[model samples]
Target chain A: MCAKDETSRPKMAKPGRSFTTLLFFVCCLLCLLLTRGQKDERMSICHLSSCGSPLADDGKVYGMCQGRHGLQVWGRCCVNVTENTHNFTVGLDLSGCNIHDEFFQESPLLTLTHLQALVLDNNPITVLSSEAVAGLTELNYISVPTHSNCSCPGGEEAWNHLIRSVNTTLCLKQTSTCTRYNEACPASSSHCVEDGPGLFLCLCKEGYHGYKCLRQGTFPMSAFLAGLGSSTVILAAVLWVLLRRHVKTA
Target chain B: MASISQMWRQLKSKYSIYHVFVFLLTFFSYAFFHATRKTFSNIKTTISSEWTPQFCNATEPCLRPEKIWMARHLFDSSSDAEPFLGWLDSTFLISYAVGLYISGVLGDRFDMRKVLSLGMCLSAIVVFVFGCLTEWIHLYSQPVYVILFVLNGLLQSTGWPCVVAIMGNWFGKSTRGLVLGAWSACASVGNIIGALLVSQVLDYGYEYAFLVTSAVLFAGGIINFFALVPSPKEVGLPEPEDGDDDDDDSEPSGEEDENGVTPRTPLVQTDTDPPVTFTQTRPQAISFFQAVLLPGVIPYSLSYACLKLVNYSFFFWLPFYLHSQYGWKETVADEISIYYDVGGIIGGMIGGYLSDRMKKRAPTVVTMLLLALPSLWGYSASPNNKTINAVLMAVAGFFIGGPANLISSAISADLGRQDLIKGNSEALSTVTGIVDGTGSVGASVGQIVVPLLHKQLHLDWHWVFYFFILMTLLTAVCILPLLVREVRSMKCFLNYQLRRQAAALVQDTHRPHSLNS
Candidate 1:
């Protein structure tokens, strides 16, 4: 019912407690004050390294590190991400491009019509938080391929569970051939037909139709018709604008 | 559910008395340790004032190749030292590595209070030992520092694990990493404190700088040992507050059940793995040596090595790089170092805070690391004007320090969420040694690598910056997969640990009947 110290050593203050104890007490007070003052002066410190002051560039400002390094601008951060779309894919390869992290949540990645596939493969993209995944809906594919080289062989499965729990089809894997949660084989895997998680492959045997080559890429023309319908809105806007200008001129 | 007043009372009962005393003792000892250790760099002006005449005999305008050699006083730079700084890092790294595993294993094997106290005692003794920095008397300071650092690395490692073990027993896992990491942000606190002390006495005395630091370390060690309780079980308290009915606690509990047992109530380590328990399970328990090396040491080593490259470079050369490149005075360099430290503070706290809040450690780490990569790449691409550069440096510092602080501080403790080391006193120390010693080696390589890269290319200092960029980028790549594995494994590990604890609890209930009958 009770947990107690195992050792039963007699409690006697160190032999010179009276004399040194006073000195130590004062010293402790002094350090606490000194350290406090030090803390106040340097209270801005945080986890990642950052520049101390802002570097003014004509009208553009950048963060300047004490070590003479230059930080990127927010606008530049956007540019950097956009310009290196391929790099984001590499970020995928590196597992350093989690779209669900704050970068996507806080930044204008949502408004950036330029971003295509949002890859979060191998990165800790397990967050199903609403904000973290909000901007990610803009992308065509949201992949967070789980690492196969894990202590648990079911990383993909867990990842699928996380994605599924959110009720979003943001793929957390590159191929639908996740060896977890569902029954689908990867397009890349040698096994043309195998059951897997979040993975689907159609291994068309000589005359098959869908998955397992049975359905092929043939959707009833209605899916393509739906895709065309979305584009018509844009064309309608352009035509409306052009007609308004013509009427005003006439 | 516990009320806020109940929590306040708990804090009062726990830390109000003895812990306060422990805090004060630690605070002072740490001051002396830092004050004395860094004092040498400041008094460069005074020492050179004394020795300048001998070197520049009446004519040649003191051609020492170093900018401020003869006219320099204490804490000033010396042409003589430029070459030595590189190898000095090596000395520290090699010695630190030599005892890396031992420090962790031994700290665990023995009473950590004793081990930590001794580490502090030696840091103070050796710091003062190096106080008389004459050519001959201080020759061994580097290697002695290595030994000191290794032990310190080991000792400081003791800090988190002990705190974790206690906190693990006292608090829930929900806020443990956050609190520990917030506590871990003390590293930045230590650095800033070291810098401040340097600023105060840079003109006064250099040796006292280190000696004071040693004293502070001694004090902190004493406080830690005296105040640190092994676990809540040891202190006779129930597991964390507000546990009665919280929705957050439900998922973890369920997660634990599916895999067999409920994942340990997020953070708090239940009263199970005492020395007696460990001994009782001797035949059945996983071997300490095997567990130490397999997943524990291996991951720690790899991550440590990768991070070391970045850590060592930033810590040792950041100030110098600022001063030399920006034409900053000593005061300015010291002041500016705060930016990096400040970012680290935020990173440390946020990294842990967010992880615990979300109940996911690996996700936090991976997210931060991944986010940091672009920042690192951006920071590295250019080093144009000073103001802009400074701003980016702060941002870079945030990305680099935040997640790093999270892992090194709180996540490391969480990683050892296993049976043998669950809330054990030595868990943090082992992780620290594994992470920090490897970081030391990275520092050593940066010491040599950056300088050599600059030497060969005759390019701008950006070359050195380039080296860090590649290192950070590479670190992100290598760790990405590993962390994914960790996250997946952790899910199961949590299940397994909970099952083991729950099973043990059940067995303990059955034992009374069997024993009495």
Candidate 2:
């Protein structure tokens, strides 16, 4: 009976210590989850109202923008009216704006990723290239000035239909740029995706990343996290024991 | 079982457990205070980039996909963002300076352990909410950020006074210099820890840096609440004698010898007295006005103000200067700048030891401050070689940081326990608060003035170094009166010692002659 009592006491003490350690880890995990679960509430829109000039309240641009469900006319740009939701520019009209070719060289319009229909009918832009309109992935319809030699954003082959009117040229039926650029990517380990109207980016497939996507396997994040957590706990325990011994001795 | 119990008893008798515990507890508590404070400086660049509008240009034609927040639109241009960031720093420092006076009084009146731990916990929450939760929730209001920082500043002010007063309560004058000197490194250590943690998790996002630091601070606060014993009296141990009673007797006479030197006879007589019992009743807390009037308080505080201005200017601008002047990467500049803090740690320990050995604080401080001028000038003149820059920077740090640490910690402790206060331990916190509070005000002014000198005045970086040299000279000048007194006292002390030795030798010869007769 005496031998059994001594053996059972050691077994009981082992679980008690482990239980507290487990509890500490559980609390840390809960804190991390709580902080991570918060909803992102940032307004996504153009920073300034005047991309150039404010649109008249009763003008054609305002009418066209107001007809959309969540769109509003801010200067020359059509952006989301709602401040809370995550949204971006969907329409822009720069007709008769007198903007030059240098404007497209480092265009702010590239940030309007959700832009669908763009009107550039009366501008003096002469050097618009596929590179200038890059990152405008959702653009489907675009009207260019008649005298300018600017092609459709991704070139003539990218659009399914093109109409040359008396005053402007309209391009429609935008096709995916990835289909044409897929061959540019590494064959086995990577895939190509359209980043913008004329830009295609090659992304490494699962478990591959490096100069040529030759490297394999992702970072062992779980192992690293586990190691970090356990080490912190161990260090804390050691410090506690050391300090406690000093207290006990005195 | 009997042998084990006997061993435990032997170990208990050998160590002063409460002393070690108090030191570790206060050291880490103040360290956590500084760690939370340092998180903002480390993440400033990242915050600026995130706040300013990004444009896709000819060289870089890709939109940042993860930039899906209003904070990106907070400023239309980088120029607008820079001034606002500067304002945040000014607000924190100004509020911190104001709060120090209040915290000092509060620390004396209330239980220090509660004040310290609670302040830590609240400050941690403020930082976590402002830097982390705001990022998570994408809250970009400027006023909210300012308000949170103000509250954080006030909470942080509780840290320094409480920790210093607690150290004063535990340790006596004999070991205060060395102990507090080493303890003072907690700030530099905290800054290094904060920088390392920020750099480690900063690649993930700036918010992660805030999360890690605040979490560490909160954990430290919880430990402090459980473990800390604010004074030796609480644990039934006799409080260490402050050594002020000996000075108390000499100060009243105000007598000088014929050569116009204060006699050191009384100071020598009390050196061999038995340890006094802890029988004096606790004194009431001193008012701010009274604390300011204490001997050595004004000189030290004024000197500290000038010294802190120079020190804080280097702290705030070093990385920016290194990056801009040398064209180094921001991270590389930041990593290199830590050499300054490492030098500070070593300088503080050496200065403390030297002052303790010499039994004079003001002379040691004045010497270091005087030396800092040359070091500062050398750092400015050196070529842009990384090794040379780092070495000169460390040398400047050693001279400047040494005196700053000595004044704020050991000197503050000395003044708080001076004989004029009649050994009132309650006044330590208030005295510490006054000196450091004044220093913070100087630091806040430096933060604003340094930028104005560079940007508005167009003095350039080299010219600004000249301004720092001027400030170092002014710091030495402020303490010149105290230095003179300490030197005079030292001369008298040496004279007294020589005369005593001669008298003892004569008595020995006479005793042998009398015995022969």
Candidate 3:
């Protein structure tokens, strides 16, 4: 009876479920089309006369555009940005820009072959990826929300992933705690850092010490004692010679 | 404790051990002197790089520019700065040369050990002050540095003459050549050690180089005072019996003798008689002019002057020249230049050994000088090939170092034993002083001229080599008259031998006839 009831319940709910599924499929199709259209509009806008212009900040959005003069469109600076001009930009400061994976993948940053520094301060960018910095051959430094101490979900992991993927130095805002900083250790030294039980501990190599392995290990006490011992013997010999000369003269 | 006299007697029984100890002491002491002296040359590149205005300024500040004390005043924008650097070197060398004669005379008159210790102590003080001027004192005044360096130079001059005299007292003329030649290598060894020390410490700071050198010199001076037995008589041992044509009148102080003491001399001997004593009595020391008039003294002195001119030029300018000509790194150029010192060591030993075996000091020196000429030309004119430059440089060093070492050591020792002096050993220091002093003057001139030609005259490196070649040729020529005298005397001796042989034959024939009659 239980089995029969269970089977009958599914049969009754089937039609409704099917209708719902169909409706959901149609909604997804519409949303996808709309998203495609929006993407097309965004790309068209990027390619147009103000292709590299920074997006306007209406007390909300913050983005930089390679304007006629330089990187512009920061609140008030956006107004003076000359229109109908494009430049081969070298740097992009996207401070306070609300960015995501899509913004990273589709942003004009990719077009700037000469980009050196990327500033993403005060941003809610939680989906940074290697693709964002992939072709930036000249990129040397990158700044992120680490400075703003913004508490975004998976923000630390996002920065870690991005930094791991890129070769340049990632300048996290001063608030970011070093989880696994390799820079703490010099090339000649080995070091270990202990955060917690599950956290990996960095162990320094021989003849080096400290969490960062900055200080070189000193000579062993035995070596110092040996040096002292030899020096004493030599001093004694010198004394013996001097005394002997004195005795002879006397 | 045993009575000091008893202990001393026990130690003196092992007189040969004392001899070896004294030898080692003099060797290391002079080497220490040279090492300290060379600290400046070894770190010259570091000084120039660290202090040059081009290396630091308001617009383009150097790494830790504040740490440099002399940068703004001594090495900055004035066009005269570079040329004045040459003068700094000259100040030291000229003072050293002038101080040579005075120190030599003092060395002869005073206790050698006292003189050496005093010199070492003063040098250490000056070098330490030089370091402090840059490090702690921060006195960037150039003239102050020059004055300190001049004092250092004068003190350094005390090293060579005093060490040679002490060693002369220990070893006789028989083994003097090889012993002094090998021993004179203290210069090159000290130079190499200095280069290594300065190179290592330069990473920390340039001032440390001078400080470390001073510390070593101070320690060495103390050790030298304790360990050095300036004369055998002071240790109650008989004099070494190694002088030319001198017969031993005193009992030979053999190893088998249970007691170390030898009896007093039998009698006073005339000047015409063969020297028959290794007596410890103070002999009349010759005047400086008399020492200069000794056979082979003037020629060897002149030759040494030229040789030193060439040597000092290389000493002061080789690394700089290599850097400018080939764009090599300063450290690499300095490392390569050290090989020249290695060649010098080998050359000095070879020259000494050959002179001893051939029993002719002048010819050996002349041959080495002549060989150096071609090597100098090649080293100067060679293309910027590292391998070729290194080999030629080593070859030039080998030849240049040979005569330079021989003239100052074995030749001076030989002149000091001049037959006219009648075995007055104290003259050794004076003769060594005169020869090395003249050489020091030439070294001073070389230190100035190399820079003048390179920077002021704006001549190519080839011109520097031309100066070297001319000096080499002149050195060989300076000794030419002596070489001629040696050859002419050899010819006369051979002729006399031939005539005697013929007369012997006739006498033998006459003896047979007279016996039959």
Model 3: lDDT of residue B159? 88
Q: Which stretches of candidate 1 lie over 4 Å from their true place?
A: A1-250, B1-54, B57-77, B132-172, B201-204, B238-288, B294-297, B381-387, B419-428, B486-517
Predicted candidate 1 versus true structure: per-residue lDDT over B107-154, tens digit per residue: 455555466556666655555555434322424333554454444433
TM-score of chain A of each: 0.21, 0.61, 0.29
lDDT by residue (tens digit), candidate 1, A123-152: 454453323323232233444444332111
Q: How much does each candidate deviate at the interface, measured as C-alpha RMSD after superposition?
A: 39.7, 10.9, 11.6
User: Which regions of candidate 3 fall more than 4 Å away from where they truly are?
Assistant: A1-250, B1-15, B45-84, B241-281, B492-517
Q: What overall lDDT goes with each candidate model?
A: 0.46, 0.72, 0.64
Tens digit per residue, CA lDDT, model 2, B204-263: 567778878887787777677666767655533455556433232232113212112211
Q: Candidate 2: what's its TM-score on chain B?
A: 0.87
Question: TM-score of each candidate?
Answer: 0.51, 0.68, 0.61
Give the per-residue lDDT of model 2 (tens digit) for A29-118.
554455342111111122232234544465444666879776765446676645443445667677766768876665556666777777
lDDT of 3: 0.64
Tens digits of per-residue lDDT for model 3 on B1-517? 5788765654455336556666777777787777776787666554554444433354331321122222344566445455566677788889989888878877887778878988997898899888645655656677787888888888988888888888877666555677888887888778777767776665446676777677677766776676676776564455654443222223333432634444222122222443333344567677888788888788888888989998877877788889999999987997888778767767887888887655567778888888898888778777888888888888888999767877888778777765667555468788889999999989988877887897799997888889889999999999999888776765666677677778999999899999999
Q: Share of real interface contacts recovered by each model?
A: 0.00, 0.00, 0.01
**Candidates' chain B TM-scores in the order shown:** 0.71, 0.87, 0.82
Deviation (Å) of B73 in candidate 2? 1.6
